[model samples]
Target chain A: MSAAPPSPAPRAAVDGETSRRRGLGWLLLVPGMLWLAVFFLFPTIQLFFTSLYDPSGSYEQGYTMTWHVMNYVDAVTDTWNLFVRSFAYAGIATVVCLALSYPLAYAIAFKAGRWKNFLLVLVIAPFFTSFLLRTLAWRTILSDQGPVTSFLQTIAVLPDDGRLLATPVAVIAGLVYNFMPFMTLPLYASLDKVDHRLIEAAGDLYSSPIAGFRRVTFPLSLPGVVSGTLLTFIPACGDYINAELLGTPKQYMVGNRIQSAFLTEHNYPLAASLSLILMAVVVVMVVLYIRRAGTEDLV
Target chain B: MTGSLASRERATAAVPPPPARRPAGRWLADHLVLLLGILVLVYMFVPIGYIFALSFNQPSGRGATAEFESFTWSNWGSVCEPEGLCESLKLSFAVSLTATVLATLLGTLMAFALVRHSFRGRSASNLLIFLPMATPEVVMGSSLLAMFVSLGFDGVLGFVTIVIAHVMFCLSFVVVTVKARLVGMDARLEQAAMDLYANEWQTFRLVTLPLAMPGIVAAALLSFTLSFDDFIVTNFTAGQSVTFPLYVYGAKLKDFPPQLFVVGSAMFLVSFAVVIAAELWRRRRSTWSR
Candidate 1:
């Protein structure tokens, strides 16, 4: 792939061409960037501004520029528990995904050769179906008379009266199942890149297979671990669907709180404040992860 | 070289004291983890299998007992009825198709800019493109709603609103996917074309686009799947319009229709077929390359 390196003279010319191309590039990017800035980013900034000023119970009400920063305080105090629950569920789900996906990723990346693509496709295939549909399926499978519960009863794991639906466990299970592919794919990508010869070299140096894995394979795959965890944890923290579908009121996450605030409760300022806070949490975590992983390691 | 010779000698010497190994037992011990891994895969697939089974099960009109009963095609029949699943499926396909195409064109341009150009605020521009994807969907939806209302638009909240939302989110994936491919590609190919007197557009069309086709196809397919499967943002933006997933969700809560499973199973089947085809195409490409 690196057979022919370009000459320096041509490289300089190429660099000039690339710069010229970049000018043209801006022309192409402007339309899309303008669209996002207008529709997405501009509104987000407006949301922050709107949150600071109370809405006069009408969409047409103009905001008072006087910063009612108290909206942030009010939102936090009101929905503190929901924020805690969101992070708690996402945190647990992240750990569970790691525990399950690591071995499966290892199996696909290192063990399976001929069937590797088949197995990877199998992992991804369920995702093609709507995520909501999959969650709804879990609702059925965990319902009172569902086969899963009946089987559990036959094995004496639960009493006949025990219900699995509308529980935190079901919500977490739905989350872990839905996001497992995100965790596995990055792990597989990293694990697949680990040179087999390095493992052999470790073995030749009198390292046991376990020791070799710990020293070489594990460290190299840390990038994948970090990326996978970030991908799963961040999204899961803000997820509302699983909690709303599979869980009772007690399982409401920050997302549910935000939804209800805006849609059900019709408190736009509170919802806007909550949205800003959630975005801040996500931005901080991403910055922290990027710093820890080093910017170059992420891609 | 010295360590290799020494290890060879050690292996020859250490084998003298060993009992002859039983190959089958060693094989079993070595493969136990992999077998267990397959078991875990089966466990992960069980819910999907249960859904598939229930979709075909006859409706007994009773709670859960119907799942254990004799099989029937009635649920599927109901899903296929003129007033039912077909309408949702048509809307889903149309919206997903429109979103994918618009996103691909705009996203590919942004990707080209990011890869092939240098500009002021480039890093921040890249981050801005990615922020929507990283932001929570509910937040995105609510903010978009606010934007529409604040702009004096009646929150169009139908096909147009849903398509715009889908494109807004899916474009980031396209940019990321295509930019990764662009970074890996050789700049010399297009440079060589330019040196041969091809104009910029000609060079891109003849040399760059073909090389970027695989990434473009993957991005398009991914965006299609995402747009098709989206619910949260679509639910917020889709006021009166009923996409398939939204329809299923509404039905599940209101009537608990047994045929919802049939619709879900059909979706699963369609997605499975597409994925399998993609896998096969990829494999064929690799073999042809070899």
Candidate 2:
């Protein structure tokens, strides 16, 4: 049932009801809000402050805020090449995911008919396994002695010494494989909402099928495209697991750098700076996209 | 059905030209989209098949062999009867279950608040809730680690820490999902119950809660899957305890254990069953509603 039709309820009655509801709502939200504020937001703010001050041995040397602005500079300029490479890999993976997922999503949304649900389930099934296991499985498949290598050799595609594992290509492939479902599901939702009659009408107007798709289907699916790309690209840019498991040192992304800085190098300031920069980049891109396409473009 | 019929009528009225006999090429072209879809599906699934096949292939008694000349259950048996593998699996399930329960409670409350009320700073809180969900897991993990260390919360990295981290991350998903369901729900039913002399708690229990159960269940299942499958965040937070993924990661570094595959396959099967069940339930509910 929809809302009750407008009745001239007394103003005092409505005010009392609304206020009571508001009070209840606040009560409901208190536990969650307090949990997040103390645990999540507070820690993140602490991280920002920690980044500004240099730690002396332990966390509590009564440290002063030095505002190591150079931490940001060092993260960007010192490891500038790595940062660029991370974006390059993430960008390529996003494009590849788009190229592959669009057709699959289109088919499931518009053409698969009875098989669409099964196909969608198939896309999600891989995620059932641990991500590490999937990455390791790739490692086995891509190893020099693995069947894939041998098959490539048989097909004359291998350059006798070319390796698949620990390469940028491998890293990108892993990223695409891992994140493709994120791209597909959103795209499918968008495509499914499109009115097929629009395409039929375009066809009736003497538009070619390709022209009809370009004019009708593609434009309607722009929201999905933008959302899917954002989902894949942002995570891909920040991914370290795949690169660490699949790629060589040269292929390390910003995520890998941050992980090492925090874990091994003990460089909290630098790590925080890098983390902030990565977040800033993502926020800016999202803001720009939202401005251009409207917030509804995101799911 | 009415929309489709009206559109079909409109099409027939507009295009009176006799249907041209479909050519062979036209038939092929019409089905090309489906064919490409199948190809994409194959690409997505083949690697999974390859992994399964490799898992079963017997280790030729020398080194790792890719050929699947023989299948053996030794790997599965070995993993099942170990000093710690089973323990790790038990810990994983326990931690995940605990996290799911906590997350569902907090997240559902947050969702209720977000959907049912208008309050100051509501928008900011909404954004804050969602931001953690979107943030990179690595950043969340390391930041939590930093936070824990800063607070002198030593040895807080075992089961408690892992569960806490999981709940923290999973809370947002639950909030988002439940809020969506709440947005679509008719609030008038609760109001009607209240009008019938039911208190707020009674109305929620009798009317709102039952209606929201499907969404709550879905949210719970999703949170469980997320917590169970999480590696990046747990890796940072789980101090001494080794969950299944952490175990697999450590095992991989030394020698990729075939047992890891068996454990992986077991997890995959369980999660797949749960997801399929959830999907079937959702479908049945929708059909019943229809």
Candidate 3:
């Protein structure tokens, strides 16, 4: 894995039968791509159609496709704050995840030497334990009488009445923690691809460590940065678990609203509309961000 | 510490080019980033520690599970004492295993096609693979549920629905992971095998499959992990069945059980041990191959 073959070798020989091989290639793609088309692409299209269902329709009577564009209008008008809040929280959490993951990924890529694989294992080890269990554990640690909250109170970083649980800070903290690996792994992948000699050359030219990183290492790792931020932000925006467990209703993001609107309330139209809105905003942001970052290989 | 130190020394010795003697400041900078990195990794493990510790905590009553009431061996001793706890665990394993198999097989095929073949609609297929991953879980879940509802499959939502949903989401990740591995591979190995008069099938079976095995294994592990830990998609589709995550979510509504933490800790221990053993085996195998 450390070999880092700089130039990518060409893929398997084309076998010299373009037409037949084309059919063969399509055969291989049929199973998985068809699955995605049916389950993913179609469902999304189905969801768009569902979003146009009459607002009064419920799951019981089945929805009528009245093209009630008002569903989207109502969804935005009603939950604009939740949309704003979700993006805000996810943005903050993504930035925090980037800040924390960059050094760790940098170390693993360039500095860990023989310990890289072991340390990488440690990074992923926590996933074996369920995320819900870990998030619940955070609830205990941030509880009013828990050590973290108590320590904060004692230090006066928090007011006497203030606590970590049921606060936006706790919710964001959970987001940062849970989605951190998403940021780190991509950063490490891109960083590991970087040529160390480039940085060494920069140093040979008497560039300082920070300047070398800024000029050489950081620029090379931009692909990872773009993907990491996207990975963190997308999930953080959609995640209801952290907010539901670590926060109060006041701290609830659009995710919490979507969950209740769909599952609890059984309001399919509203849920579909909310989901569309979220997906649209995310797709737009991601397109612009990817355009700026210039990495079509992210997928 | 000594093992790591000795290994580091051996690692440097094995390489032909000795690293130049760095100034004190450079050495400090190098070690400082590594130290900072290790510290962050350790900090991430705090919750796992808390889970293991809390598993020993037999919360005295329904309201006390959030705090450590007292330490006792009872929770571990009777990990399955809570009703439906073992049942949910079994269901989760069954669901995740089936999903992992389906996702890995399909994804490996897609990855091979994407990386090794120039076919029509390939870029479109790549976009298809990317779409599910880019979409939020909530969006995917809601959309899937909408599709099911429209098809009148909502009433039959159970084990099968959960498996389908898991495979759908896990497929994208598996494709990407396997594709990365395939793209990085040395294709000359396959060409050499072919040049040696190995048939296409023989070369693929002997060379390509073994090379792709690591990525497939990783993708399978990832799919299983994602399926097991999944809440949103499963919740949307799992109508009557209770996977472990569903069980955990349900526990919060009523009497939160201390046994949940015990089960969680046991899972951590078992999985961590397996991972460490695999790493050791991989190291030994790599060294032997070298």
Candidate 4:
């Protein structure tokens, strides 16, 4: 490719063409950027502004922007338990998803020699069905008289009268089930990119297979682990569907609080404040995680 | 996808000692991960199997149960018997279609700009794209609703608001997917077109656009599914407008008909078939080209 003689004129011409193309790039970027600015960035700023509004106003009467930032204090104090529980549930679900997905992704990336695509399709096929319907199915499967509970009871895992429905266990289980694919796909993507020779080199260095996996493969797959956990944890924290469908009020997350504050209770300031807090925490966590993972180009 | 079993076996043959003297413990260790993977797959499908079985179940008087009662095809026959069910489904389809088209068109343009040209603030634009995907749906939904209310569009929250919200979230995925394709594209093709004296428009239309179509199509499909299956963001923004998920939520509170399961199962089957067909077509196309 570099065998041709270096020509100054053509090189200068190429530079001029690229610079001209740069001018046209803004035209192409404007449409999408403008849309995102109006709907995404602007709305986020609006949410922050809304968070500082007077909390005493009703939804119909409208909120007044009095710069009363105490709404954040009030919102946090009011739903502090729910906030903690939400992160706890999400964190546990993320860990569980990682544990379950790592092996499955590894199998597809390494061991599913001829059936890799078929196995990957199987992993994603269940997601084609409605997520809400799938969660609802969990409700039935974990109901008091369901097979899961009955089997648990038979094995003495649960007392005869103990039930799975309306429990934190059920809510967490729903979350793990729902976010499994999110974790698996990213892990598979990174694991599949791993060069087989690197692991072989580690093996030749007198490392056991497990040692090679830990020292070489696991480090290589960290990007996937980081992104997968981020993807799973962020959404899981804000998810109210599992809590609403599977668990009782006690299992309600920050999402449920935000939802009811906005829709059911009509407390705009509270909801807005809560939403802002969730966004801020997620952004901080994501930035810290990406920096620690040493991957700047997440997208 | 390319490595055959024989190649994999050969690859491992170079790594391991001869099988004649290999320890049984090492063999079990080698296969344990695959076994665990199969178990996880079965675990994922358990609820799906339950959902499929319940689709054929005769739930006692519209109250959905997990129990597999007598097998009946009534749910399949009258899938739309539930009031407002089909209406909700239609609303979801309409919203997903509109969101997909708008998001795909705008996102493809952004992808081309990011990949094919150099510009200041390129990294900043990339950050903006990642922000939406990173933000939780609840936050995105509430923030959009807050913006709308502040702008006095509170009462007008229905189809338009839902579509807007869907497009906002779907944009990031579209841009990322199409940008990947654009970035991985061969620049030599466009260079060759220019060498042949093809104008920029002609070159783009004939070479670049065609190469990016599969990515754009995949992104559109992904956006459609995300929009259709969305419940979290839609829930906050959709005022008095019930999508399929919202309808399902309502049914959960009241009585869930077996027909809901039928709809879900049918959706699964249709998507599965489409995916299979796409894979087969891709395989055929690659073979033909080769």
- Superposition error at A70 for model 4 (Å): 1.1
CAPRI class assigned to model 2: acceptable
Q: Tell me how far the alpha carbon of residue A102 in candidate 4 is from the true structure, in angstroms, after superposition.
A: 0.9
Best by DockQ: 4
Error of 3 at B27 (Å): 3.7
Task: Give the DockQ-based CAPRI class for model 1.
Answer: acceptable
In candidate 2, position B209 carries an lDDT of: 95
Model 1 stretches astray by more than 4 angstroms: A1-19, A55-66, A151-160, A295-299, B1-32, B62-70, B82-84, B191-202
lDDT of 1 by residue, A1-299 (tens): 01111212223347677677557868989977887887788889988887887644544455565587888999899899999899899989999999888888888888898999889888887777678778877887888888778888888887878777788898898889889888988899899999999977865555545656777788889878987987798779888999988898999899998888777776788899999999889877876776777644343
Fill in the DockQ of model 4.
0.44
lDDT of 2 by residue, A1-299 (tens): 01111222322258778788778778989898887887788878887887776544334344568876666776788777877887899899999999999988998998878777877888778777878778877777787887777888888887878788888888999999888887998899889989989987866654446656777789889978987887898778888988998898888988988888887777787777788778777667766766787544244
**Candidate 2 chain A, run of 10 with poorest lDDT:** A1-10
Ranking by lDDT: 4, 3, 1, 2
* Per-prediction share of native contacts kept: 0.43, 0.48, 0.68, 0.70
lDDT of 3: 0.86
Ranking by TM-score: 3, 4, 1, 2
Candidate 4 at B204: error in angstroms? 1.5
Estimate, for each residue in B1-290, the C-alpha lDDT of model 1 and write its tens digit: 45764775477556542333434443563486477668768867877887788777765564442254778878887776524567887899999999999999888988877776666767677778868866888888888877766676664678988898888988878887787777779888988998999987899789999999988987898899889988878877787789988887776655455666777677778878877888888789989999
For model 3 the TM-score comes to 0.93
* Model 1, global lDDT: 0.79
Error of 4 at B94 (Å): 1.2
